[model samples]
Target: MIGERWINLAVPLALLAVPLYALMADEPFTITLATRATILALAAVGLNIALGIGGLVSLGHAVFFGLGGYAMGILAFHAQNYSPLEIGPLTFAGTKSMPVIWLVAVIVSAMAALLIGALSLRTSGVYFIMITLAFGQMFYYFAISWSAYGGEDGLSIYVRNGFPGLNTLVPIQFFAVCFVVLCLALALNAMLRASPFGLALNAARQVPQRVETVGLNPMRLKLMAFVISGAITGLAGALFADLNRFVSPSMFSWQLSGELIILIVIGGVGRLMGPVVGACLFVALEHWLGGLTDFWHVWLGVVLLGIVLFARGGVVGLLTGKAGPHV
Candidate 1:
């Protein structure tokens, strides 16, 4: 059997190779599909940090995801419309720059995580899940009612945000952008998982009492993990919006959050490359199977059930002949 580390390395390289092949084959749509997988993988990576490593089973991650999308949409929307964004006494101009939009997305998502986690982290078990879901639903409805930015119908950005030295309008170039960001996010996850803070967070998840006895605040650690997760997910959301050139209330839907969890679950929780593998599988299934039937979700559910009952380690775990640790 192959080592999981090798499998991990192969997964990312395979993702990269596919799009490169697509580019050479003049398959622009394939590149787009790969880019979508990359962004979803990035979002799952964020959730892995929280639910996988930190044991925070949140269901409201769509809040951060939608916020990130809206951040980019609102900024690009204003830029294209030749209007300024006004927040009370302060007046600011919108930006079409990817860097600027990403920064705003990360900061806003992190701040929202802090506030939501501060409250939600106080609860445990199913209550935490419910509260997070409630928050997600709240945002979903709010986005629907936000008529300024197209409200329930969503907002569209006519132009893809500009990235320095890259022609984002080109499919391959845009994919490169998402791929690079995904790699960076993966690197961050790797470092965070192996760091002292990660160990502490894991400890808090595994045994809060022991962590507390050691003069550490478990809640604080969890909160930080949640914030980091949100920031990464938010960045993915921004990229996703750019990919589609649109943002909608559906971005905040509970279904999106559930899918995020499914990606992690199917990929293998707590593993560094779990989300990547999961996202690839999901996109592949969605693309290929979806063409055959509208009830692809039923197949997806069957797959999920099998993974839950027969192979708790997920795809990665199965390949390595080991079931990974559950959250």
Candidate 2:
């Protein structure tokens, strides 16, 4: 238990170095690599709530992620075009600040989640997964067919989104935002796990019948958790769109959804810091393997197969044992 605590504490602090190293590293490739890894980890953390704790096993989380990215992209486009988004009667525009983009991302993703969860939560097991995946594909196709924001090609931003006090375009500063957000997500996960609501959610995951017997509607609890999960993942998506200064349908694809699951499995399902560690290891492996061979995914597949076959609990589980009961 003490070892677990130490690992838990050490992991976040160690992650702080990612931005610093990226800034000071001589190689630009390494810096970009770290930046991408941090953002991906943030997305995985959001998925963790639904998959790890709620046991929802949603295969279409990419929908929320893509929604968040498109939020950023759409807003940035409007802002650049200096055009107002005309609603029924209210005309809206965009801001250059990151906070504004993040807020919009959260709201949009939450609303989408509420809609999807309402429909999808009506089903269970394979049906739920299929419904979620179907929703994700719907969004993916919409993005591809919609020509407003570059359609299938994608939309790019001339400048990185700004923060009040930092140079958003600087690699280190941007990475710091990603790292800090990742830390915040982990902290929030820990807090939620310890909260009463989190306990109920976890109980629902283990035994919905028991949770329902205790006067809690498992569906209500799961739906709430799903909304929160989608909002968090959407925030990560906003940052991701900014990281690439672009957004495309690819962000909403089933492949992206699968990768998010792979992150959880590789790190240690239900572990707060698992996504972070998994993201780092995954990025490192991809980098190294890519340097060695053109078909790096072939090697990555082999490695992932090994982990799934030999490692029951993933990297974090191997290092720190099973997560606590709450997790």
The candidate scoring highest on lDDT is 1
Q: List pairs with backbone clashes in candidate 1.
A: none
What does each candidate score in C-alpha RMSD?
0.7, 1.9
TM-score, every prediction: 0.99, 0.95
Error of 2 at 3 (Å): 2.0
Compute the lDDT for candidate 2: 0.86
lDDT tens per residue, model 2, 1-327: 336678789877776666566556655566677788888898888888988889888888999899999999988888988988776999898767899999999999999999999999999999998999999999999999989888899899889989999998877778888888888898899999899999999999899999989899999999998998999999999999998998999999998998888878888788887788788887888889878988987876876787677775677877876633433
lDDT of 1 at 132: 98
- Which regions in candidate 1 have their CA more than 4 angstroms from the true location? none
C-alpha RMSD between model 1 and the true structure: 0.7
Q: Give the TM-score of candidate 1.
A: 0.99
Local distance difference test scores for all models? 0.95, 0.86
| Per-residue alpha-carbon lDDT of candidate 1 for residues 1-327, written as tens digits (9 for 90 to 100) | 669889978988999999999989999999999999999999999999999999998999999999999999999999999899999998889999999999999999999999999999999999999999999999999999999999989998998999999999999999899998999999999899899999999999999999999999999999999999999999999999999999999999999999999988999998888899999999999999999999999999999999988888888989998878777
